[model samples]
Every structure is written in structure tokens, then in C-alpha cells.
Target: MKSTEPVCQYELKAARDAMEVIQGKWRIPIVISLTYGTKRFGEIHRDIPDISPKMLSQELKALEENKLITRTLHDSMPVTVEYALTPLGMSLRELLDELRNWGKHFRGEIVGK
Candidate 1:
């Protein structure tokens, strides 16, 4: 049985806000990469094959702005930067795992594999 109550605007707006933050082909992938461990710019670019440097830079900025990831700078002979997921970002682990499980199930069902 389903409740007949209409969905509230607050609920819809919250969902939309979540979607807007992660909205982009690269944002999720970028977050996925950071899920493993901290990585430098090149490593992230290589991890997600075919993403141009410019795009990766842009997405990293967005994720950082959203407080999902932290960018750290190391000062050596030359500066190095690394990215790691924030606590907020790590909060998505369970969600990502669910997506992975569902994707595998869907693939098996649809592809008959």
C-alpha cells in the first residue's frame, strides 16, 4: 500500500539540489577515482581514460567547491597537488556500492550474462 500524500516541495528541492551538485559526466567518475585514495592530477586523468586535462581540472574545482573533496598542495622543489575525498565525499561510498551492485544485476539480467 502506498500513501496518497503528495510529495512536498522541500523533498523535491533537496533531491534536485543533490542532483545539481553531482550533475556532469565527469563528476561521479572523478569522485569514484578519489574513492580509492588520494591522487595527483595526472593520476586522476589517467584513471578516467579519455578525460581531457581541462575537463578534469574543471570537475575537480567543482567537487572541491561542493566540499566533497579536498585538494592539498605539497611544496617541494616543484609544487604537487593531491585530491582526496572529504568526510562528506566518503558518505557516498554506500551509495556508490549500491549503484555498482544494481548495475551488475541489471547487466546480468539484460545481457543474459
Candidate 2:
């Protein structure tokens, strides 16, 4: 079978940086949740039921620090905060879609499901 692209030439530092941001039990799921639209902290937590509030806070900070997501505050009777993906983060849609397809293909091959 022919390969799609040349073997990856990713730099160790660059790869590690990428991993550092998404390195968690919930980051990818969080990203997927945000894919639907910008969301408030509680909304994101509700979407990913398994993540603890503390862990979710930590992960959100990491994502913001890495420029993958933006956090905003709204002033009202009750303050509100929302998070949205940056352009760099939105670029992951293609990669994530590819991963879903590959995972489905691999699972079928391995588990006969």
C-alpha cells in the first residue's frame, strides 16, 4: 500500500509542547465539547460529566496558556465566563476528524466490531 505523506518530521520540542497542553484525561474531550460552540465553565463541565471541577479548571488554564482557547468574562448580575477556540485550536478539527476515522477503522480491524 502507498503511504499518504512522507514520514512525520516533527521536532521533539514542538511535539512536546503540543503534548503538554493536551496532556490530560479531559483536554481532548473538552476540545470536542467546545467544538459545538463557545461555552461557559459549568456548561463544559456538564458536557464532560466525568471531569472534576478542579481538574477542569486546571485544564482550562493550560489550554488558555497555550493559546488553544480563550476565556472571557461578562459582567452582569452574575458574572459569566465563556471559552472559545483560537484559530490554532480550530485547526485541530481536521486532525481530530481523521483520528475518529482511523480509530473506527482500527477498532473494526482489531475487535471485529
Candidate 3:
């Protein structure tokens, strides 16, 4: 794991593909928010501060198109829509957790927190 070398071509392509799918600033946060279970549009916006309605709508559509999350329209009195992670998106949970841990460690090392 400590090899200081470039990744193989296949691994490079795979990492690039993942970066393409989860490229934008809001995508990962959006996915993280959904990890807590399904939530409505407003709830997601509220959970992630500073994301505009338009951007959230656009990202949600992109995530759905990428098959990471599902958008369900519930037939209730007022018609509610909820977003939930598909198995593919849930697959990122461990990776995200690892990233979080690394971020904390890096911050502590660099900032002396």
C-alpha cells in the first residue's frame, strides 16, 4: 500500500471513470446525505448547506442517470418525492468513510488540531 508508483492503466481508467461519475463538488455531499436513508428534495437541500435548488435538481438528475440513486414519486395527497441510494451508490459508503478518516488525520497533522 506504500508503493510510490503510478497506477496501472486499468486502475487509472477505473479511477478516472469514478471521478467522472462523482466529479462535481455537490455530488459526494449529496450522496453522503442520502446515506442516512431516503429524503425529500427540501430535506437534502437543508442537510447540505449552500446548495441552491437548481443545482440540487441538476445533480439529482445526473445521479439518477448514472444509476447511483433512485428518485421515487410517492402518490400521496400532495405527491412527495424521495431520493435513496441504489446499491451502486451505497457501495461508496466504505470509501467515503475512509476518506473522512484520512481527512481528519491529514488535518491534524497539517493544522496541529
Candidate 4:
């Protein structure tokens, strides 16, 4: 057997790790919406009405832990929080664009819609 596994295990693991960061029902939408600019919890929720509040919060925390998004707290009355993409997250724009294009093409080819 001439190595049935990946040439580099770390690289394979890294790719899987990256996918996990954005893998979910709401993570990609959350990331795409943030491209418009920083937004508060409610603003994000409004932008993606299909996602429930708890799911959104969970995705936000995952993105934050992955260093993909940053959360800021405002010291005003009642305290408001906002989320923005980190440099790593912003750098994903090109990749995201390509993925979006590919998805459209794939859907069109398959569904003819």
C-alpha cells in the first residue's frame, strides 16, 4: 500500500477545521450579511429572519472562537453589542465570491432555474 491517506495529515485536518468554522445552517449567511458592515444582534437577526435567536447566538460564538468575527460592547444604557468580521474573515471575501458563483452555476445546471 503506497500511502492511502493524504500526503500531509495536518493539511487535511486544517481544511476540515476551516469548513467546520463556517459549516451550519446560519454561519454562512451570518458571514455574508456582515460583509455589508458591522451589525448588532437584532440587526443581524432582522437581516436573516429565518434563523432563530438561539441559533444565531450560537453561530456568532463559534465564529468568534474561530477568530472569524469580533464582538464589541457599547457602554450605553442597556448595553448594546455589535459584530464585525476580523481580517481573517474579511480575507474570505474572494473565496466566498467564488463559492457563490459556483453555487449558482451548479443550481442552474441541476435545476434549470
Can you tell me which runs of candidate 2 are displaced by over 4 Å? 1-17
- Which pairs clash inside model 4? none
Which lDDT tens digits does candidate 2 get at residues 30-85? 89899999999999999999888999999999889888899999997699999999
* Candidate ranking (lDDT, best to worst): 3, 4, 1, 2
lDDT of 4 at 98: 88
TM for every model, in the order presented, reads 0.86, 0.82, 0.90, 0.85
lDDT of 2: 0.88
Clash statistics: count for each candidate: 0, 0, 0, 0
| lDDT (Cα, 0-100) at 44 in candidate 3 | 97
lDDT of 3 by residue, 27-70 (tens): 99999999998999999998997998999999999999999999
Error of 3 at 45 (Å): 0.7
Considering TM-score, which of the candidate structures 1 and 3 is the better prediction for this target? 3
lDDT of 4 by residue, 1-113 (tens): 67676478888899898788778778889999999999999999999999989989999998999899999999999999999999999988987898899999999999995
True-vs-predicted CA distance for residue 6, candidate 4, Å? 7.5
